[model samples]
Target: MIRMIIPLAIFLGLVALLLVSLETAEQRKLVASPLIGRPVPNFTLPGLHDPDVQRSSADLQGEPYIINVWGSWCWACREEHPYIERLGNESGIPLVGFNWKDERQDALRWLNQFGDAWTFHMVDFEGRAAIDLGVYGAPETFLVDHEGIIRHKHIGPVDQTVFEDLMRRIMEMRSEAES
Candidate 1:
């Protein structure tokens, strides 16, 4: 009937308008990235190696440091563990670890089996705290400065080349700041 067609046509038109609007209009979203010079989200979470203790973001103060978020559940983390060890052992900057959402026993076991490359590793169980820090996955590293500000972020496995570049940049930045 004519009446039925009018309502159907109106519904179709509204649907089409919605589709077109969505195509043309960008959705508002908070994009998290570390290009440079942004204050890192501060946190104090339980330590994996020490449950009764907490690792304070404030402790990262007074020195430029490398903070890596990782877990035994992540494959890339397994691949990158040795390199992380290298960085922790050799890098001029202080190295810290955030052992993300993982089994407590497994985390402790992993560090025991492989090595505790971190100065002190924070145990982030359930990943709620890591989510607040904008963590998408394991093996992500944030380079922070003496002021506890995030200077840079690396999203994947970092090799010597990447490490070299970032360290070079941080050194340059530090030199500039001190002068």
Candidate 2:
């Protein structure tokens, strides 16, 4: 009876430790990306609106922009769509969308339904660009500076708080660049 109780207690302790670790990881707002502080990956994907038109990292170099990875199948993208639209409208910032592994028609329909917030949507049907950016899933965003360096990355949906934080960072970066 004593041996059985000890073994049960050990098992419970291990389970508790695992749960704690997982909870701590989940609480983190951003997952560190290897590409941070590096140049944006070089890849030209077709435009979501017009497949014949393409945009590459070179096109995004003139100004600071946010590259938001999303898909029609991503529920979190839907949840965050309004805030993204607001960010684009209110801030007048260039917001680019990387449509990851999604059907072009579905992506267009989704954007049409939710309201298009992106200045230009890059269609990444094969997810090759996403892979280069170290994307784990949809709804991840990368804040690229004017020189095309990836300054920060947000792993989840961008909410009001996240948007504010990003704005603050961008302002700081701009100020630093000017000075």
Candidate 3:
């Protein structure tokens, strides 16, 4: 009857909508950060390896660099470590390792086991600076341009495709600076 058909049609439509949403879930995970195009948040955090030494945003102002927010406890950060290592060694861009909300010893242990790839390693034991930078979670990367403006943000793990995209963007930024 028409009544039976109407119920079936509604159920099928709901299922289809759910399927579409599931299909695009990965794409949806990459929500653009509001900090894009804005200057890097100012912070003076101590070095991870040596707390006595301090690094600040002001010091990184003249060069394009990457700020990778990660914690020793994050499994996703482990998954992305190789790609981050590649970025640091091959990208020709300085990478600032922002160790967020982690115990100093654990962060150092993780780096020692995995190999440190950062141009500078800074610690944010309380994550206050990360809050200013709009960090949602670990493994977030922000690419800052030469003038210290944030040009791109990648949420979650950086795999091969993401690495390629970041490399391309870095190249573009360099060319833009040259002109």
Ranking by TM-score: 3, 2, 1
Lowest lDDT 10-mer window, candidate 2?
170-179
Top-scoring candidate (lDDT): 3
Give the candidates in order of lDDT, highest first: 3, 2, 1
RMSD of each: 7.5, 3.8, 2.3
lDDT of each: 0.78, 0.86, 0.91
Q: After best superposition, candidate 1 residue 65: deviation in angstroms? A: 0.7
Minimal lDDT window, size 10, model 1: 26-35
The better candidate by TM-score, 1 or 3, is 3
User: Over 4 Å off in model 3, which ranges?
Assistant: 1-15
Q: Please state the error at residue 10 of candidate 3 in Å.
A: 7.2
Candidate 2 deviant stretches above 4 angstroms: 1-22, 28-30, 177-179
Q: Clashing residue pairs, candidate 3?
A: none
List, residue by residue over 1-179, the lDDT tens digit for candidate 2: 99889989999999999999898986674567889999998999899888999888887786788888999999999988888887677655588888999998899889889999788889988878788999997799888888889999988888889989877887776665566
**Which candidate leads the pack in TM-score?**
3
Instruction: Give one clash count per candidate, in the order shown.
Output: 1, 0, 0
lDDT value for model 2? 0.86
